[model samples]
Target: MILQDFIAINEKGIYCLYGDFYLDPKEPVATAVISHAHADHAVSGNRDVYCTEATSAFMQLRYGKNAALTFHILGWQQQINIGGVEVSFLPAGHMLGSAMVLMVYQGVRYLYTGDFKLQPDATCEPIQFCQADVLITESTFADPNTAHPDAGLEIKKLADIDINIMLGAYGLGKSQRLIQLINQHVPDKTILVPHKIWPLNAIYEKFGYQLGNYQIYSRKLMKEQRQFVYIVPPFTFDSYIRATGVKRLFASGWKNLQVNDKDTLYISDHADWNDILKAIEQVSPKEAWTLHGDGNALKQHFDGKLPVKIMN
Candidate 1:
């Protein structure tokens, strides 16, 4: 039987039948091995949750302090035996505590990469490559035309701005990364963020990331019409700051973002088509399975090179 048969994509998520564990299960399950703390990837109410130390903390913060779930902290390179399978975690370089899971069953190695990027991010651990027999990966930005510029170069676009810039970002990973990037690249600029981002920022700093001086956005402060960089969740951009007249900038990898009078910075945390192919080449997987986003690009790219399956 093929190694791919051991791991199947069910409605719940990618399930490892032999090991009796789920990788980043979308719904609550008996045993869940989470890759990161992103809402789509990590959820609460699982009987058992397996993830890195940082991911565990993120889960607590996201699910609330009193979340009733069994936690298992799996450090990088720490291997454990579960249901007759050997499993371990590796750095994914996507966010503060992102990870790539490796499972070995019956001498065949299978690597499941949660969301990941090849670029450097001082905010989190770097991506680590390893050999695997079968590789299951995310294809968020897997189009051949998609290419991300250097993170520092992308963040530097805000340095020359003179007006108070209203930056829209996801409150979890992107907000923290942007804060650190601005601090490192444009230190002179004062940064302001919505109250919602405060707790996540505290967690990032608690994990030893040094984000520069930033204050919570106040209506009084916004009333002053001061020239400062203000970051807020994308969803709140319209209602929260409706009356405030500020230059808008969005930091994301999507090429064709439709925002009125706003500049889109192509900064992404997922690997593009070339990088996806490169990662697969590095892993040298005999078979590949693609998930997340539109997996067509990966499937077409590996059409004849190796057997590829698009996981539903």
Candidate 2:
């Protein structure tokens, strides 16, 4: 209850009144504690930004040199005081450098899961659990019907096909994951990415996420008859599919899309419904609040179990 008084959702983002910092704020602020380098969570133009080293590098890659007024990099479990409140970052497991913001005020701990996944992803750090009085989480796939299948199975399908496979993924985290998955499952096939994703691969490699054998896409290679796995951002998928005449697969968690029968892979980086439930059970917070996506399902499912609120 006291923590509720200290933290509140504002127009910019979740604000810590006592700490005077914002958690993954949307707009610019004096001090921003970012969860990850995803554009939706870690926006540019904040006066001061705090995040993990990987996230800082990601920010630099995405936002350029002038991403923030100043940067304060924090390691996992490394605590720093701001406005007399102890704050730290924990691994989120969503992607490389993704983290959960933890704040301790007056001996009571509060944890915020910016965006996380329980499923294993080789391209990033594993999720770290921390107990807290209040738990704030993202409900991207909170619905009971939403469940992700094994990502390895999906990758295996791409390997079995005879023709070249063209996969569409979000450029930031998802693209890197696909590269690793493709390499692990079908090491023989050549893995190729568009120009935009090439730089991201370098960053991932710099952080020790070895994405085996891969190269940037080329028009000359496209003309060749050899089977190659081409991964591109969603925006460019349609163009590449039409020009290259390759089998297309979209990797995402959404199940109800009108994609072709064998063209969609239910591979997601966000925690599914069961994962959400497990996280709540693990945290055992006095109060639980959900944000992002449609959180009504989470509120309804945990109705009498805890004090659950669907945050807008």
Candidate 3:
């Protein structure tokens, strides 16, 4: 069977024609096989949503009553039938509950990798791969020149700062991961989390991933503490751009987010070019399909080796 005929990208998102379900649809649809609970991938209003248990919890936490009409929670590697197609979830390693959707129909397998990473993270499950006939992957950091440094080493950079740090990070997955990294690498420094992110931390803890030694943020704590890291969401971080008496830093993989030369922390959750190459090699698909970022580099890299298609 042809791969595109099984699943193809449309105006909404990647649609699985055989299963009659959308994979991370842009808008609400009858059925959505969510890869994760990130706002971009897991939207509210779907009639039936299939995802990991943690992903369901996060969606409920973020969207409340509007999460979804029905949630079909699946454990890692657990397979279910959806419209005559067999579907399963595998760890994506990008964040807690993140997964790569694997669908099989008529003995042909297609793997849809959402945002994923190969970097070792203490807070979430590591990525796993399976052989497939067609591999659909995200190329967020697919440039051959782009390589993510060791995350543990990057977190250690915080140890050098003697004063309080105003660190900006995404409130969901990124913030939780940062909390654990700081606790593990720079044990001496205190980690302060804002109200916006505290709930997410609790959710992570509920899933049995212990995030060591962090307190809810307070002005009193900020005034009394020294050598502490104040983690805030982007909006709060931006508002405090000119705040005095603390060192400013943003934790991200994107170079553009690192505005300060001396205070940049290059910790990223997405896979770099090498990691993407490694995933493709492990999956060993007959053909490769790329999405989410520019796939020209991948296409060129596999020009004579493998057939690579850039999905719009």
Report the lDDT tens digits of candidate 3 across residue range 1-312: 645767788988889999999999999999999998889999899999999999999999999989999999999999999999999999999999999999999999999999999999988999999989889999999999999899899989999988899999998899989999998989999989877787898999999999899998788887886788999988999999899889889999899999588778998999999999999999999899998999999999999999998987
> Which runs in model 2 stand beyond 4 Å of their true positions?
240-244, 256-258
The numbered model that scores best in lDDT is: 3
Clashing residue pairs in candidate 1 are none
Using TM-score, give the best candidate's number: 3
Q: Which model is ahead, 1 or 2, in terms of TM-score? A: 2
Model 3 clashing-pair count:
0
TM-score on alpha carbons, each prediction: 0.94, 0.95, 0.98
Please list the C-alpha lDDT of all candidates, in the order they appear. 0.84, 0.86, 0.91
Tell me the TM-score of model 1: 0.94
Between candidates 1 and 3, the lDDT winner: 3
- RMSD vs true structure, all candidates: 1.8, 1.6, 1.0
The segments of candidate 3 whose C-alpha lies over 4 angstroms from its true place after superposition are: none
Candidate scoring better on lDDT of 2 and 3: 3
Clashes of each: 0, 0, 0
